[model samples]
Target: MSRVSILALALGLAASSLALTASAATPSANTPSAAITAAIADVNRPQADRDRDGDRKPAEMLAFAGVKPGDKVVDFMPGAGYFTRLFAKAVGPKGRVYTLLPGELATRSQKAVDGQKALAQDKAYGNIVPLVQPVNAPVFPEKVDVVWTSQNYHDLHDAFLGPADVAAVNKAIFDALKPGGVYIVLDHAGDKGSGLRDTETLHRIDPETVKKEVEAAGFVLDGEDDALRNSADNHSLKVFDPSLRGHTDQFVFKFRKPK
Candidate 1:
């Protein structure tokens, strides 16, 4: 063959090899990595009802937060370390999970103190770190990939935090997230126009109010998941009341810091 003909033949062979390699590199859904399977299994472990039951957030919510095996995560007011333990395992050893304890209440509340002690003793949670801060202060070391708060937003309006303090807390959350980082909030839903009244009596807040306050802190409303929706909830019962404890109408919202 002529020199040009030989060169053309070599190029054709290289292209075919490249195509074959690319096809082989694609990952399949069922192809479980040993590390990921182990992490998921740990998350599925059976535990006491108090620690495990309340931690049963919808799987979709975890996906929406973009939680991976090695991303830094912060669980705000991780009262009892329920979600904190899950996050610690989900992130694996390569990732870190910071359980932000409400500083003002941590030392004063017996429950918070006991929870912290228990979490510290768990060998499976070596990746977890406890951060103590005032209810309105965000004392995380730096911005993280995800900041998760569950059923605690209404407490922001409680006498302890109040409106002004809550706004500061919101701003702190915004600052604690990296650009494009996610803030996942799950809270009980109050009456549509009840404003902040439900916060005091029912320990709930209107969804609209949550959206407005979070948006005011410079986060964009990314999306919401209805996985926890319950049409049977009348939105008038207190979240801690026996009637609503496990069945409150809850809203799940995802907000993102702008890149």
Candidate 2:
């Protein structure tokens, strides 16, 4: 063959090899990593929890948050230990998961405390540590990779929880995470411009408000996933309005502490 013909043949072979390698590394159709999928499929997960998988979308959320095996995680105010269980599994044997409950609630709500304690004691959830702390402090035993809270950020302003200092809470969360760690907040969305007005009543907050306050803590707005979003929500009714209880307009925001 001529020199030019030989070079063309070599380049084509190299390109073909690279394509095969790339395809091998990529998961198909958004499936999570094998470790994550294994955690989600663990037979030990509570049957009730498994039933809710359709709506909670645990695998999608974990995948988006970049939760990997052996990454320390904190489930902030993990009521009833729903996500807490999943975190424990995702972190696996080498890692740990902490369930931090608002101190007041831990002391006052026996049921909530009991549920978390039970999970912590379960052999299958050996990686979990249950803690009680004031709403104002996002205390953790050590800096962790991810701090996750679902459907509860707005409660910081509730008369029952705070009028808690949300800014201080955000700062505490920032301090508790290692550099480049993730903070995942999932909550119901209020009407545009609603601000904190509807937090206590409607149990929702404007997504913009949440973004601005969290950004002020010096963390970067990494990305947002709208997998849980529901445009059908009118945003006027309370989250428990019954009409829209199970399906509310929600947002999943992922923020990163700069490395």
Candidate 3:
């Protein structure tokens, strides 16, 4: 090859390599999923909220849930607006995040209603809509793309739910989602054979039980993510136990409404 042509080709290859390196180092504006990027860049997020990211794996969990911009999501029992704020931002301006305050929880503690109401009025979470309803007769204004419940599924059996017909709650959720919608459940894991034995005391439920109950609602188990799992947890201690408070082993399950 001519010397000029050879040099030109070498320069072209070097430029291509640099471009590729730059692309890899700095993801394009379109590269990181909107949901993932928003969760990371949410400056209004409190320091205490950021502090829990290590253990809660909010980014990983949202990615697993397949959350995206312009999606309508329901943050089931959005206690203290933790994931509520993230979901609100994840869905962006065109989308909406409904933070549910079940009557069972609200009637028991006015704090639940007050907290969610405060979030609804926050200009930072402009896309959040507070949904207040009785646990047994829960409903949504419109079908949603995703219904997410984090660290609170076992509460279905809590006395506060009072003869809680978990089936009804599940059915209400099933009815409120689009045919192909997603349901993401993240909760502390109980021992393999524990069943509901420890839910009230230890605040943990067997992953198998959760799957079975959710599947019975006519939803299919789409996938499971162990990003928050910790094999070190023995499943005996309460999730609130001082030793395992933030390190409890948890399971993340994704269920899909049949299309």
Candidate 4:
């Protein structure tokens, strides 16, 4: 073959190989499993939560977290039992979901605490356990399979809830998980290079800050997805502000403790 013909052939082969690698790495989001579907469709889930399903993407998030029957999960700071209830149903009868409520959050939002306790009593989601304790010290019932915290990850640094010793909490979470277990942190994103500065005012955190703190505890950054990201959000307003409440730009990160 001529030199130009040989070069084109080599480039095409490299492109084909790269395509195969990309295809292999991507998980199938189009087809959710039976367990995840049932959990999202559970009749007992409050309508309010169901309404927000489009924005929160619970099924996608659960599938991303790889929750399965018989897996033990720690829904860290599971406010209002939103993800907590979904987790309880997803894990099924053989599995368990611990709603890890901090003593600080209980003081801040008693209604959330009471709601969690009530769900634990209901037979439908009986697999839930409300584990309340100090923010810095996390004592899980058993080394868990997954420890997930949503929008509230930034609160661990805020004055209202924490100014919490984040390193201590991350270390505690590290110790509480089984080797190979996953730690998923989903939160709103602050502006570029802001680091932890926006956490208190915007209730948003720089994704880099989360990675640094989590990796310090010996966890590896496993995966991340843009499923919840909204490009329109500039990340300046508070997460709870009227215009930004449900549509804020968010990030989903999955970290794992190595075996």
Candidate 5:
């Protein structure tokens, strides 16, 4: 072939390669499973008299937790049945989602009491089982693949519960999971080195403190994801102080029980 003809052929090949690369880089329209997508849509839909946005992150967090259609899951303190519904759908009909609401909350908070009552009757959440036991109680019928808690860890440090009670709660969760099971936690971020101070005022907790505490319970820190990181947060303000509210900086950690 002539030199000019050879150059033109090379250019054509390069153009084709570029086109293929572009196509490969573009995200596909393939969505999450129909069941999961539908459940997420239902949770995001606006409801009458509901003030807080669902802020559902199960789709993202479940990915981090490596939750599968057949994995058993436990949603600790599944307030208003938000994550409970998501877990129920993600685990599908074959898997189970135990919605473990602290028995203390059920007895003290009328809203929690009503929510649990409503969840018990929801047909859509047939895979969900409500376990109204104290946080320290091992009421799970079977070992779970994933034990997940979101925005509720800070409450464990409340004055109403002492250190022993909090430690017992963590241990109970540790015992309920199978060896190699995952424990995924997502909570508001507090100031670095603030210890548990944020738990009291801002309803947040230091990520370092959480790691040390869970490690003490025989959980290994598998990994952490920066998907929820927000650099703008100063971490001094309360999560509910209007300035932070829905956009507060958050941390996500994945711990595992050793097999």
Candidate 6:
């Protein structure tokens, strides 16, 4: 080959290699999922919800969860419908987002229950389905694509949630998912070795404890993302503590039911 032709081919190959590398890394993180981005930008989202976006990093977390259009998602213990609304939008018209309000929240306060019902009735994100799950015997209507709990998994071990049978909760989640479906547990991080010790007081639990418990229910650890990690958080303060409120160190785990 002529020297000029060889040089041109070498440059072309190098450019192609770089493009391929970038494409490979895109799906790994921070890449915009059209559905997620649209959901976040939806006009129906409350201003208060939007204000927390910077700290909560919903886009990154949603992307990590791998939510997509037409997915069936369970937003377990969906507090105030924050993620319920997001999931409904992200899943689009054909998908369904089930707001699994535990029995405590369902019966303890009528206002809370009414709020979820209200959200479900909204036309903007009419795909949301609201249901109350008994703490001890959680029930989901059908196998879904993803089951997710955010910042509240620790509550399952605390008194507020009947100190729910964590095992049963896990198993229900395992059963609620289709084979190969994902379960996402996102929560505040506790000190490395402290298992459930901090669940009630500090409102945190070690990341490993979550892995062990979920795995015990027959889920295989699939992937984890550090998108929400705040290294400066020492795992000592309550999640509501003013100094650490919005920026508390958090962990996001993805476990899959075996296919």
Residue 165 error, candidate 1, Å: 1.1
What does candidate 6's lDDT look like per residue over 1-259, in tens digits? 9999999999999999999999887675556598999999999999999999998888888888889999999998777788888889999999999988888867788887888888889988888888887877878778899999999999999987878899999998898899999999999999998999999999999999999999999999989888789989988789999898989999999999999
lDDT of 4 at 58: 87
Error of 4 at 171 (Å): 0.7
The TM-score of predicted model 6 comes to: 0.91
**Window of ten residues with lowest summed lDDT in model 3:** 27-36
lDDT of 5 by residue, 53-134 (tens): 3344545666677777887998888777766767777778899988787877777788886787677668766787778887
Q: After superposition, how far is residue 245 of candidate 5 from its true place, in Å?
A: 0.7
The candidate that wins on TM-score is: 6
Model 4 RMSD vs true structure: 4.3
List, residue by residue over 116-220, the lDDT tens digit for candidate 4. 789788887889888889999878779999999998899898896758999899999999999999999999999878998988888899998899999999999
Q: Model 1, stretches more than 4 Å misplaced? A: 1-40, 43-46, 49-55, 160-164
Q: Number of clashes in model 2?
A: 1
Cα lDDT tens digits for candidate 1, 72-141: 9988877766667667776788888888777676656878877776776688788877777776766777
State how far residue 129 of model 2 sits from its true place (Å): 0.4
Q: What is the lDDT of residue 43 in candidate 2?
A: 86
Candidate 5 contains a number of clashing pairs equal to 0
lDDT of 4 at 45: 91
Off by over 4 Å in 3: 1-32
lDDT, candidate 4, at 249:
96
Clashes found in each candidate (C-alpha, N, C closer than 3 A) = 1, 1, 0, 0, 0, 0
